[model samples]
Target: MANLNPYLSFRTEARQAMEFYQGVLGGDLEITVFSEFPDMVQNPDQSDLVMHAQLTTPDGLVLMASDTPDGMPFEPPQGFSVSLSGNSTQRTQEVWDALADGAAITMPLDTAPWGGTFGMLVDRFGVPWMLQGDSE
Candidate 1:
């Protein structure tokens, strides 16, 4: 089966962002630094930059991220969101609250007209998210 997962790009904050996500999503995170790779470090300063990071949630959600190489252009994400949807009201609300910390809320979490709880926000790392709970 094919699956679609979000791959986030960061300048030098991939490690922080992945850790934050793990805390919010209850996941195990694996990260590799550029220094870990053979001859991949371009600059001494960038040695500790994340080359790759993956967060796998208990529910099978996988989020990947990496820090852009020094010569590559870095653009923050826009025009899209990492949508989280499920039937667990408690878990949904917990995620929403966790992501709300240091986030800019675009839509407050509340009962939506569709008969469920819904909300939107951009996390501290500039990743947008939409969280929706089951119909009530």
Candidate 2:
């Protein structure tokens, strides 16, 4: 059996981003820092950085993330959006509102020509997102 989910990479914001997601999505989050594992422990200055973090939402959605260790290349997210959709317009709208805080809304959520509500934005963490909901 196999499960597919989004795994995010951050220059150093993995903890903050993951915490924000938990606040927006109602989830249980588990986090481990580089300091927790001796072998994986980086220099003392970088030891507190997030090594891994996972958020499991009440709806069973899973999101994972980690910070790029010091000296590694870092790149901002681009080329794709984390697309979210659902049958319940109200519920989807709730999520949209949460994610919209501190977000740059590229397209306001509204009726789509294809017969649904759709919007796009780049969230505060620099992650792009596309949201959709059924027209109720």
Candidate 3:
């Protein structure tokens, strides 16, 4: 069996970002720093950087992330949003509100023309998100 999950790239905030997601999504997060794999971290300064972080939610949502290794170019997040949609309005709202904390709301959560509540925001970690709730 196999599943496709979103893998994110951060300059150095993978730990904080993963923790934030865990709080919002209710998940178990496992993090590994570059130092854990000595061979991969050539620079001592980068040893403390996140090599890998995984957050697995009870609903089976998996979010993975890591920091850019030494000498790798960092690219700012753009052009995409991690979207969440479901029939549970209450649960969707709760998740939206959680992600809204200190996040820049590009579109306030509201009833969409296509029906249902929809919203867009860029989290503090610079990750974009879209949330949707059931129409009715």
Candidate 4:
């Protein structure tokens, strides 16, 4: 079966952001810095920057992120969110609440017209997210 995972790009703070997420979501996080991949590093200063990071929550959520190389343009667009949808409403609410602790919610979690619960928020790292609970 195929899987859907969200990959994020950070200017230079991917490590800190991924660590913060690990705290909130309770996950196993693996991070690799540019120095770990010597072949990918052209600038010595960027060797300490995060080249890639992956977080796998106990609940089976996998999130990946990376820092853009120095001098590279990595602009995240506004008005878009990485969405999470599943069959457990209660579990979905738990994640929603945890994510909203230090973030701004654009839409309160509530029943959607399509017969599920939905909400949208921007996490503390400025990454927007959407949560949805599937219908029975």
Q: Using TM-score as the measure, which candidate wins?
A: 1
The C-alpha RMSD in Å for every predicted model, in order, reads 1.1, 1.2, 1.3, 2.3
Model 4 CA deviation exceeding 4 Å by range: 1-3
State how far residue 63 of model 2 sits from its true place (Å): 0.7
What is the per-residue lDDT of model 4 for residues 1-136, given as tens digits with 9 covering 90 to 100?
Answer: 8998888899888998899888777889999999988999989988989888999999898999999986788886476688888848887788888889888989999999997899999988889989999876
lDDT of 3 by residue, 1-136 (tens): 9888889999989998999999999879999998988899888988999999999999888999999976999998998889888747778889989999999999999988998899999999999999999975
| Inter-residue clash pairs, candidate 3 | none
User: How many clashing residue pairs are found in candidate 1?
Assistant: 0
Q: Candidate 2, residue 129: CA error in Å?
A: 0.5
In model 3, which runs have C-alpha deviations exceeding 4 angstroms? Answer: none
Alpha-carbon shift of residue 85 in model 4 (angstroms): 1.1
Candidate 2 structure quality by residue, lDDT tens digits, 1-136: 6898888999889999999999988889999999999788657788888999999998888999999987788888888888888747787788889999999999998888987789898999999989889878
Question: In angstroms, how far off is 116's CA in candidate 3?
Answer: 1.8
Clashes of each: 0, 0, 0, 0
User: In model 4, where is the ten-residue run with the lowest total lDDT?
Assistant: 70-79
Cα shift from native, residue 13, model 4 (Å)? 1.8
Model 4 residue 26 CA deviation (Å) reads: 2.9
Give the distance in Å from residue 92's predicted Cα in candidate 3 to where it truly belongs. 1.3
- Residue pairs with backbone overlap in model 1: none
Candidate 2 is scored at a TM of: 0.94
Scanning candidate 3 in windows of ten residues, the lowest lDDT window is: 83-92
Model 3 Cα RMSD, 1 decimal: 1.3
